[model samples]
Target: MNDESWALSPNTRKPLPQLIEDKIRQLIDSGHFKAGDRLPTEPELAQKMAVARSSLRTALQRLQLQGIVEVMRGRGWYVRSTSVSDRDESLVIDSRISDSDLMEVRIALEATAASLAALRADDGELDEIAKRAREHQGASTEDKEELLQTDEEFHAAVVKASHNELLEQLYRSLVPKLRGYRRNSYGSAELHNRSANDHNQVAWFLKRRDEGGARTAMTTHLLGLYNDLATQAGTAAGERAELNTFAWEDEPRWRDR
Candidate 1:
């Protein structure tokens, strides 16, 4: 790719990372870059685009999150196979359960669980949640299975810390139902990073014994996942608009208390 092709006007509205992301996507879409092709090194891309390495990395991370490219440690970035084979079973889980339905129940259960965990979890339990969060964050994006495993463990640790056997039991029962949804939503590197960050926030609050903060953090985290899944499900425009605004945006009833 020519450096001139990457030149952006000072008046450009988008952030540098987003601009670079769009440029790279265009290149891939136009076949200038194809599956299995290696992208230029970070230094080369930064120089050619006249952007900082950080910005270039952000763009590449976004691409990786979109499954457009993947990174191999010690090697450069490579475009990944986005093609769906006829035998693809990525979404072959129980069709009776919709993501929104699952998320609705999760928000109710896990948010309360997070709050209870903040009040009840001992130092060791809190440390376990923190450890799981860091493990998920450090897990390589190339290993989707490991990444998802770490994520699940992190959530499981949080629920277990709540010391509520009923909540834990319900959550354990729901775990199998969540596997397909996890595979569907946790595809990109960016989403993985976001989840890790949210987990960190949840852990932070739990450690501080901040019940409200823990609950809010957990709710916000799950809401983000719910919104992502809803958007990807291709709802109508009006419904999409509604879905974008979460119910929590309204004033909390407890505010009057």
Candidate 2:
């Protein structure tokens, strides 16, 4: 089809699901939307992409199930996975389950995660992990903001350590809401320090290419952090950042990449 013809006539080639999914993914990858940023409503997205609302919803549901996007009861979908926000944010597993039950699930999920990562992590991804850790190493105490940023970096790496897309996506969704809550109300450094050593040890293990060590270290690391945070705070305050406060970076990470 000619270019104008194609633009004027609805796309008749690709499946509607694939079309909407690709458009949404492009918007995300292009930095038109960002991690934690809410997407346009399903109707809006469908109109923007020229697809049926049902197809758009299906695409969003797929993204949500895959962990790249998250759906709140009335809030709509948000971008969840990214290199920066994932760590600074704390993890929040969805549940009616008790902390103990969640811990068991984490053990099974993260252990297998490390094993797969040991085999799958590419050199480039590993380098990214190391870079974030170094950012943590030099983070100044006076730089609470930087420290918070670095802390997120560190956890984001561990989530990355699993080398599984779903794991990264899941942790991304959970961590930010968790961390944002802590930052908003109590600002608990004592609670954060409690988990730093485990984070350090896990980072060291992954760097060493010790699969067994990585698996065990990460498992314990997450559980300990979970307990420490759980003791301090169990639920997000149900707040969101003011638009001016965490303004979308004018030049975001993705534009050049």
Candidate 3:
């Protein structure tokens, strides 16, 4: 028998392309795919997955966009990770960020917005928050997208209420991706309902302008997911917390645009 050192041992469970991408991400995240490491060619991957090269390519392209891998014209693809940064930028753009990274980002954004929202939101904004919350609650399973949209709208509205246009715009840009990652990473009905409940509290606090309550609610709401992601976040934040320290929030934005 010709033994291939790189081959994943055959398992009863077959992996789809999406699953393959996720597995590869876990490998990269765990240092199995180090920076400058050349991923095996498409045919090698196809053999390993017991699938076609095309599917592997599709997975690789998705990873490419996630900044998990970089493709070179002649040299082939290499793992793109260095010391992974866990701040706003890393969380904002990571298409396949683990559940823990999603939770961490949510804690920072949601808790901060909660207080700002309660303090600065106008009546119209408060009403909008109510309308979206009701809309989310009323949706049946057929309206998953709407439920998801309303969830984002409720939180983004809180960020907008902060009266800082930059924070509002940043939230606007990040929330869609945030929602998308959570859906992909968790995809649990219980988690979805939990997210809605957390959002409802934020909306309620917005209406009442209860700064302390909002902050506490947002922080508490994010805790479950944060705990869930904590094990995975060890790669970026726990032992690696020192490299994770980049003061982007303290850095000034040249916002003439």
Candidate No. with top lDDT: 1
TM-score of each: 0.57, 0.46, 0.49
| C-alpha lDDT of residue 193 in model 2 | 56
Give me the runs in candidate 3 sitting further than 4 Å from their true place.
Answer: 1-99, 185-189, 229-257
Clashing pairs in 2: 87-152, 88-152, 89-175, 90-175, 90-179
All models: lDDT?
0.73, 0.56, 0.61
Query: Which should have the higher lDDT, number 2 or number 3?
Result: 3
Score candidate 1 by TM-score against the native: 0.57
Cα misplacement distance, residue 237 of candidate 2 (Å): 24
Among the numbered candidates, top TM-score falls to 1
Candidate 2's residue-wise lDDT over 101-140, tens digit each? 4444554566667656666777765666667667665655
Q: Quick one: how many clashes does candidate 1 have?
A: 2
How well is each residue in 159-215 modelled by candidate 1, as lDDT tens digits?
Answer: 878888677656655655776678566678898889989999999999999988898
The clash count of every prediction, one per candidate, is 2, 5, 1
lDDT value for candidate 1? 0.73
